[model samples]
Target chain A: MNIQALKTYLNCDNGFLLSLVQKFVEELNDTTNKITLAWQNQNLTSIKLNAHKLLSSVKVMQLKELTLSLEKIEAGAASKHISSELEEDIKQLDIQVKKVINDLQLTIEELEANSPCI
Target chain B: MVFKCAIIDDDPFFTELINHYISQVDSIECCGIYHNPFDALNKVNFQEIDFLFLDIEMPEMNGLEFLKSLTTLPPTVFVSGKTTYGVDAFENNAIDYLYKPVSFARFSKCVNKIKAHFEHTRTNSQVKQQNIFIKHNGIHIRLAVDDIFVIRAHDNDVTLNTNVRSYKTHLRLKDIYDMLPLNDFMQVHRSFIVQLAKIDKVDGEIIEINGRTIPVSRTYLGELYERLKIK
Candidate 1:
């Protein structure tokens, strides 16, 4: 996760990028929770929809690895039953999203420290 | 001139990102950001908008479907994550297509294309507006220069005949003739100015126009012959 590279792509100030990252993390958390609940209930439709929604933000963040994982989960959700491998993929997706949230928080802190006002 | 634009996308993040990119360009203005295509369809006036940044794969009503539903569409640029929608976007006359994770560089290029398109359209419209307006029965009637067949003067009123209808206006024959294209229309009589293209057949001193035989006076006969290239 090259946070600086993503910021350059967005071409926004540190404050704006920080706000975007915070929003993205919040949305990601909510979507992950939805996927988990849908999986527990064996509602593949809900899982597919939630995973599809998550893909948009992940792709924007340029997290290629995470994007592929989410795509697999989204595709697998269309199936009647979740295979053991698909279950492992969902578990990995949760970990990967949380790791991104942590990395983004660190980036935000670094950005805040570099600001004159801070 | 600043071009007012609207963004119709299901994702709030994508809309926000596009809005941010639009702010970087000085000539483009963000008028509205609609998260729902259905809401945009109901609210947006296609004629009023200068540009539209649309996204495909939206829930409920997709971008392509929404575009199909519009009676008139502005220049549209499709911003989608999926590359498969590119073919359909161009087929529907979209100005450009920017794949998701759209960079500011890519978005700026699309804006340039839109500017060129607007300039081209404005130039064409200016040429089309070379027309004359006459007041008939308290209403101003506009007639294209090429559409007017003949102009006849009777005392104080001038009747202007066009391909569609005729209008009787209180204007001088000379005044209306001055407004018409000099090369296309010629005064063949004191009260009649016939569009050269509208003259079907000329027999002796009379010219047939829409079943009406208008006589060419002797004073202007030589000039008419010169205009018609008659030996």
Candidate 2:
């Protein structure tokens, strides 16, 4: 993801965007965990709801690939059973989220180090 | 003077984001931020707010539902992630609809709209030098300042009682006070402002004008006495 482009979209400074990114990462972790537990318990309703909520944040961050995967997972949870295709999509979403989280953290650290006060 | 505004949204992040955007603009001031629409209804004085920024998908009451519930609404702009709400938003007479995550350019466009709206209102108000133009329904009816006896404020509405007729308009008393000629008018009470020449009699605690008894609160009594040159 283009962190600079995201900051420009938000019309906020690096520190503020970093804070929002932190919140997004936390929410992503929580939602992924909820989806995993719901899938293990065969609770399709919870999986669908959690995926739907995550889709909003993912779209805000402009993560097209992850958003598409989450949309598919949410659709599957709504109508179809938790099959191998849905499982693969969920796994891919989880991987993408983790990678984004790592990239955001590195950006945050770089921003903090470059600040005059620091 | 900067126009005061309020934000109603359930999401803290979105509120913060909007607040940040508002801080960049010098002409607009964020008066209050409410996470709950119910709380906003109870707390915010709609009469004082010039504009509102609302989110569509809130927890307790959605923005559209809240807008529907209001009797007198300020100019509003809906900010949301869903593009499907654009039709419903305009149906309720929203000034503009902004999709999230709202960029600075989009937000600035909305700000320009607000500026143009207020500028137009100011220009219209200034056009009539001797007469006060009050919008009744959709048309601006010119009422001479000389005919107006008392300006009474109740809730969000203000009534201009003239010698021949009374015109009720949806405008704040303070806003009307600002528009009226200051030399000819004096606010004698928090909810009452009377034409200086229309004062029939000034009693100890009340003033009578054209058979209407208007109370004079202690807070404004001193200024009223000074303005009238009453010892």
Candidate 3:
């Protein structure tokens, strides 16, 4: 994660940045579950919407891998297909989001340990 | 003057990001941030806001539907997560369309556009307050409101007598009267609106202004006397 760039763009101190990333982690976990459920249900609309929403957070976090995966999932919904490939893409997105969430948690811990105000 | 703005979006994260952007700008103030359109409609005095940032997809009502329900709307910028709503936003007269994950630079550009729009509107309003345009001789003429003395109506057109010249235009006397400053102009009869400063004499039934005699109706004579500060 490019915490430096995100911090500069936000113009926020360490505390606000910590909280924002924490919120992102929470939202990421919830949205991943939503997209997975939507994909399993063959709900194209839900899949598309959740991916689009998650894309915003990933973009802001500068997570290029997750950004590309979310974009593909969003577009995949448009094809109205429930093929094995799209299912695999959804599976990969879930794994990547879980990994990112873990990394963000670590970043949060580091920030708290380093900054007394946070 | 600091411009007041509001944000209506379902996503708290997006709204918080925008609020931070607003705090960094010196010329803008965020008056309200709503997670839904329903609360915004009930709480916001739209007349006090210069512009708004709206998200297209919310649970209660989409941005387009919310805007359509209102008779008047401030300038709006559409913030959304997808590219699908661009044409719809254009049709609804959105000032700008921003896709999700907007950077500070992109948001700044939208704010600049809003500032320019408000500046242009303010300049035009100032001009309108001081002058009015009337069509005469197949051409439009700009007449200073201070120079006009009388508006007399014929069957189909009204003649505006100014200090420079009298121009006749096809308009109703009441319609023309509404355009003038109410404190300086008064309708004294069914067909006449005379500038209060130009009234030289207010006799029993006749009023004299600029070497011309106009009749005053009983309906307005008392008000005219009161306006002229005559007992």
Give the C-alpha miss distance for residue B171 in model 1, angstroms.
26
- Ten contiguous residues minimizing lDDT sum, candidate 3 chain A: A109-118
Note the residue pairs that clash in candidate 3: none
Residue-level lDDT tens digits of model 1 in B24-140? 876677878898998998888664467899988776788999988988666888887679888899888788888877877777788899878766665554533468888899998
Docking quality band of candidate 2, CAPRI definitions: acceptable
Q: TM-score for the first chain of model 3? A: 0.94
User: What's the true lDDT of residue A85 in model 3?
Assistant: 79
**Clash number for every model?**
0, 0, 0
lDDT for A103 (candidate 1) = 84
B1-231: candidate 3 lDDT, tens digit per residue: 246789998777788889988887766789899988999889887865768899997765889989988888668899988789999988876778998888888888988888677656555545345688888888999998989999989988899999989999987675576577666888887788999999999888898998999998776777889999998
- At residue A104, give the lDDT of candidate 3: 87
Ranking by TM-score: 1, 3, 2
Please give the CA lDDT of all the candidate structures. 0.81, 0.81, 0.83
Q: Is the docking of candidate 3 incorrect, acceptable, medium or high quality?
A: acceptable
Error of 2 at B223 (Å): 32
Clashing pairs in 2: none
Please report, as a value between 0 and 1, the fraction of native contacts recovered by candidate 3.
0.47
DockQ for model 3 equals 0.33
DockQ of each: 0.30, 0.24, 0.33
- Sliding window of 10 residues with minimal summed lDDT for model 3 chain B: B120-129
The TM-score of predicted model 3 comes to: 0.66
